[model samples]
Structure formats: C-alpha cells, structure tokens
Target: MPFAASLASAAQQAQAAAGAAGVRIETVEDPERLFAVSRLLAEVWATPPGHDPLASDVLRSLAHAGGAVHVAFGPGGMTGATAAVFGPPRGHDLYSLIAGAKQGGRGVGYALKLAQRSWALERGVATISWTFDPLVRRNAWFNLVKLGAHAAEYTPDFYGPLDDGFNTGDRTDRLTAVWHLNRLGTPAADIADRPDPDAAPGPDGLPFTARDGRSLWCRVPEDIVAVRGADPARAVAWRTAVQDVLAPALADGYAATSMTRDGWYRLTRP
Candidate 1:
C-alpha cells in the first residue's frame, strides 16, 4: 500500500478503537477548544499553574498557522491532545511538540497519534518527528513497536531540566522519534528475545558502551517513574548510564532502530 493509504488504514483502526472507548478525535481551531487542550496538557504533565507548557494562545497560533491541534474527547471531557508544529527545511515535515492523554483513557494517545498522521498526510506532510524520554518503557514500546516509529537521534539533556512532575528530578535526555508517516508496521518482534529487567546494570540496565559494531542494545529501568520517586540516586544512575551508552553512539552515526520487548533500545549503524 502507498504511504497515504497505509496511514489512512492505521487511522481507521485507531478511530475504531477510540470509538469503542467512547472517545472521538477532532481538530480544534476555536479559542475555547484550544484552551481546553492547553489545560489538558498541563493536567496530563502535572505542570504547575504558572508553568503551563502550551499556553492557550500558543495553541491558537499553531492551529492558525496550519499546524495540527488534535483533541481527543472521552466520556468525562477532553481526554487528550496532540500538538504539532510545521517547520524544517522541507516544509513537508512536522515536529510533534507535545502529546498526552488523561488517566483511564486507554487508547486515546494512540488514536490521537493516528489522527495526527492522517491530518499531516492530507496536507502533504511526509514525516512527523517527536521526542520522548528513552527511560519510559511504555512510551518506548508505544512509539517504536506499536506505532512503528524509529529513533533517529539522541540528545543529552535535550530540554535541560524539565520542571514538570513527570520529569522533575531527571535530566531531560530524549530519543528523537522520526515517524516516517508513510511507514507503518513492526520492524522486528521476534528478535527481541532478551529477558525482562533485572537489578543488575547489564542487559537489564544500560548496555555497555558501544564499540565498533553494527548493532548495540541500551536498557532502561523497568519502571522509571517509580524508581525516580523512590530512589532518586538510582534514577540519576540510569540517566548517566543511558547517556554514556547512547549519546556517544548516536553522535558516532548510529541510529536507534527499535526498542526490544525487554526494555532495550536497539541501536544500529547505517
């Protein structure tokens, strides 16, 4: 199937899922709807009142400038939102700046992502790129395995120190996920044969520093959120370990290809 068709099919599947959960996705341009989305973002991130990441005006401007501002509504109210910014040299690419969903909205996040993909495709956008903390196992699985996005770059402290509740104590390192809007499908499933996370900092932790090799494995804590809250030192250790493994390799021309089932990032050289 062509890229657009494939994306459309994926979006259809996601829409069905959303509908089954009593959720619907819509494009928001009006100030009231956009303000609701901004509030949802702050709530999802647990951002303090004075530190709203996406102000209402910002979302309004983005919607007016041809960027996507997809809002997902569920039983209670606004359940999720996906905001993208149009830019880059190609003009056919978009950077997904922020996306989040409310608690208990099981498939709302994926649905919003599919909606964004469809929205971008209709407007001739070829790719959508976003960043996420590599240590978040669920997010890694969602972006890499479930959504079929590939990690193209790694930046240490990408956003400096994010003060949001989710990122309070940790360095803001991130893996840049390039969702080739045209590409959809699991790249590898059976290859991820590694075991689940263990306390040892070997395969269960961060992989050893990348050497001259075609492929490398990077591991993250099984539950970084819990670890960050209970053991700040361990969380910092996880941060340094991942930085040591990925920052160097990514700088040396390696791209994170996929994440394994056992919380490992598979990095490979082109």
Candidate 2:
C-alpha cells in the first residue's frame, strides 16, 4: 500500500481496535493530564511512591518537543498509557519508551499498540521500535505474533537493574522489536517443531539450542514474574539460560521470527 493510504487504514484500524477494547485513546498535553498518565504508569509498574517510571515534568517536556504521551480511558478510568519519542538524528522511527495497561482489560494493551502505530504512521514514521524482556512469553507473543513486529536485536542487561514490581532482582535482557508500520498483518501461524530436549539442558533443566543449521529454539519460563517471587534463584537461572541461547543466536544473524504460546522462541537465520 502507498504511504498515505496505509496510514489512513492504520488510523481506522486503531480507532476500531480502541472501540472493540472498550477504551478511548487520547494524546494528553496539559500538565494535569500528563500527571495522570505518570500516575497511571506508576501504578501499572507498581513503582515505589517516589519512583515513577516517567515523571510528569519529563512527560510534559517530551510532549511539547514533538513526542507522544497517549492515555487509554475506559468507563472506569484510564486503563493504559504509552510514551514514545523520535529515534536518533536523521532516523525515521519512533521509539516507544514505556507502555502498560491495567490487568483484566482484554485487548487494552493491543489497542494501545495499534494506537501507537497509527500515531507514528501519521507523522511519516515507517517504523516503531521498543525493547521488551525476552523472558516474558506473553510479551513475545504480543509483539511478534499479535502485532507482526520482528525482533531485531538481543540486548543483555539492557536496563541494568530495575526496582519496579515487574523487574526487580532480575537481569533485564531484552529483545528489540521493530514494527514496520506499513506491513502490519494477521497473527503469525504456529510452529510445528518443538525444541529438542537433548540439545542442551539449562540450569532449570530446560532445552536451549539450534536444531539444524538454519533455526534455533529457546525456551522461557511460563510465568517469569511468579518464578521471581517464588524462587529468585530459579528466576536468575532462567534469565541466564535465555541469554545464553538468544544472545548468541541474535549475534550470529538470527532473528526471532515467532514465539509460541507454550513459551518457545523460534529464531531464523537470514
């Protein structure tokens, strides 16, 4: 599709998605609304009282300087929020810094992402990039399968250590997702082959290895957050296992193409 037509279609799709999710998307500019976004995100991340992920003053500066701070409002109240800024100099991509939705709202996060896509396309940006924890299965599915984005890089310890409720006491290994706005499509089909258990056993007894020369399969914990809380040592082991598998594959020119709901990351070499 041509750029203009594609952008229009994306906008319409974003609108329909928000409607289906039973939410309203808005770009808030004023201080009060921006502060609301900050508070909402803080709650979403379960940050400490004085440790908001993004401060309201910083959000305001970004908004005034051509960045975006979008909030999703449902009947109850704000259900989700996302903040993004333009990429490096001379780059035509938008980098989503943070996004989160309250629990129990079906499709709220998806709708927020579609909204971000439309927002980026409208401003002549063809790509939107973000980093997500590689150990999170649901996030892998959401970004790669649901949104049709591709994992472009494997970054070990991307954020060092985070004190947020979701990320404390864990290595912040990340997969950088690059969504090609114009090429959005349906969810990816399922992969048939399973990871070979004999290839290599990780610390947690999970398999992580390349099957054949062209593809690799890595496993993630079913619920990393719960594992972190229940057994912090096991959580660290899972993190190291995934990093041992994915980091080397990505470094060797393999891209994570699709992830299964059962927690398998399928990577393919170019």
Q: In terms of TM-score, which candidate is strongest?
A: 2
Clashes of each: 0, 0
lDDT of 1 by residue, 1-270 (tens): 876677678678767867866788899999988877888899999998968889999999988888879889876889999999887777688899999998888888888888888878877888888999988989988998878888868888888888887899999889998888776646653443443433445423444333233577766778888888988988888888788778888888888777767666777776
Q: Name the regions of candidate 2 deviating beyond 4 angstroms.
A: 185-189, 208-210
Clashing pairs in 1: none
Model 1 lDDT at residue 119: 79
lDDT value, candidate 1, whole model = 0.80
lDDT per residue as tens, model 2, 167-221: 9998888899988887765445355665355557766675655465667777788
